[model samples]
Target: MSRKLLPDFLARAHDDRDPSPWLALWLDQSTPLPDPVKTAWLADSSSASRQYLLPFLRPLARTVIVLLQVVKVFFPRNWSHSGALHALLVWGLKRFVSPQANWLILRHFHLGSQVLAFIARNSPAPVPTSPLEPTDIDALRDDLFLKHDLNLFNFVIRLNQALRDQGLELHKPAHLDLTMLRDPDLKLEDMPHGRLNFLDLQSAIELFTPLYQLLLTDNDFWRAANSLQLDETIGIYCATLLAAPEHLVLVNNKHPLVPLSTLRAGHRLVIHGLSTEMLHALLMRFKQAQAEGGVVHTTSGDASAQ
Candidate 1:
């Protein structure tokens, strides 16, 4: 009977409340990799049994489908770390937000209670309290994340404190990725897409900010920035200085450049559309720049700073 209703079983398991991803789930659980792995979207779609079964399921997983499978197996089996459930919900949000693989989190373990709380909190329209699963949905109604999301500085400070509480971290000079300045070689496959060509401050800095002697090259800079600036301490304020090429793209809000006004007070400037020599000089300038503002002094200072 369980096998007979396996589709519904998976639908409930995924919480997608739809059946589309269920047969894949069943095949996955029941079969080994070569077989389950080979099944594509079409194989699951063509069957009436599969189609009808989808409405009975929901796609609850947000991380790699594989991780949710692990979580599902663990959660219903009375796993201790219920917070992992919340992790999966965050994973699902990540999956929906960008199908790209940039982050390196393997499990992203959250406890189960956290998961239900998150679901209760993040429903497109809030659900009325469910007494049966009170902890699952309603508790997340606490208003913390929506109000005070952390930025790079604050996140780092909090992380340091967390490490201290755990007795793992020490006060030391922190490292960050620095090799983000160089442009990748321009080829048929190497042209800047909107995501790379236009940039946001945090993301752009992360990609180019090489950690522990990570270095960016001219090619990378070309691909990532419209222009480049170097702060005295190896801090950078690269900007998207040029209008994009007309033939390849249209200027949207995501143009791969920054306004001059956004540049920080402490930087060595390289103008847009510079000659190769100018760019080379800018590279030298960045090499000469110091590392960061200074060592993270104290979280108290960070709190006041924020």
Candidate 2:
């Protein structure tokens, strides 16, 4: 899509009652986007100020990252759970950010919490360190986002091992033996390298933490930030479904449907427009595909089946 026509395409995807057509376009990544078009995509997710300031924020963000590491050494278990810290952060976020920005922030935490809980229940892995089931959107952000990013990181590692042990892939389906997960034999390890690392959860959380208040009404900033959170949540869940046993399959392969690689490249297909609802609709498409025997051909070209 050309830069000149990109906004119109975004409008159609974002505004139309049925966004399936535009969704198809956004999900296709075969046609490499130009740098300008990629910038437009970023702009659609964030403010120009954010885009410009993000590069500059690197140093300060790094300092905050180191500081957080030091604080964790001293307080390990309690550093992130301070009521005052949570309250102050939430007040600042809610008071300074746009409602759209706030929604993106809250929704991803909520979904992340839900998805983690699902994985914990279904996988034969070490249980997540933090409570996976959050009570509300507020708890999702203040508790899950602030208090448990590392724990989520830990859980993904163990879950991957458990899947591997069972002769299964995270993105492919096999009937998981629930009894085996009852006393999972997996061990937590340092972060895995390459694609299995998935999203850089801690760095991503840190990247936006300092900017929440500064971004003010920049919903796009929150959208761009939360989109990373969304990527982790969606990636794991979609992978879980794709690898689901025959009876549980929701998708055959990721391909032209989800744009997993494109999301990691910083495009906003998953977080764009009516995010959560759009995800549900996408899942429904997968469900329909399952009913039709799990074969989906797309213009994006990759047609290898799971």
The number of the candidate with the highest TM-score is: 2
In model 1, the worst 10-residue window by lDDT is 297-306
Off by over 4 Å in 2: 1-46, 63-81, 113-137, 147-285, 291-294, 297-306
Relative to the unseen true structure, what is the Cα RMSD of model 2? 14.0
**RMSD to the hidden true structure, all candidates:** 24.5, 14.0
- Stretches of candidate 1 off by over 4 Å are 1-21, 29-134, 151-153, 160-306
lDDT of 1 by residue, 1-306 (tens): 123222234434544565545455535522111221123222323444334532332221112233433444534333232243334334332332111111101100111112222222332222222111112222322321111112222333444455556665222122222333332221212112233222211222222222101122223222223222211101111111111111111112122234332222111111111112122223223323425444321110000000
Cα lDDT tens digits for candidate 2, 1-306: 333324344444354565644345555654333233333333334443344644555566656544644444544332222445456555544444333234334444444444455456545443453444433335544444434444554655667777677776444335322221111111112112232222222223344454432322233223333434433344445445545222212222234324332112222323332233223333334445556766533221111110
Displacement of the residue 166 alpha carbon in candidate 1, Å? 16
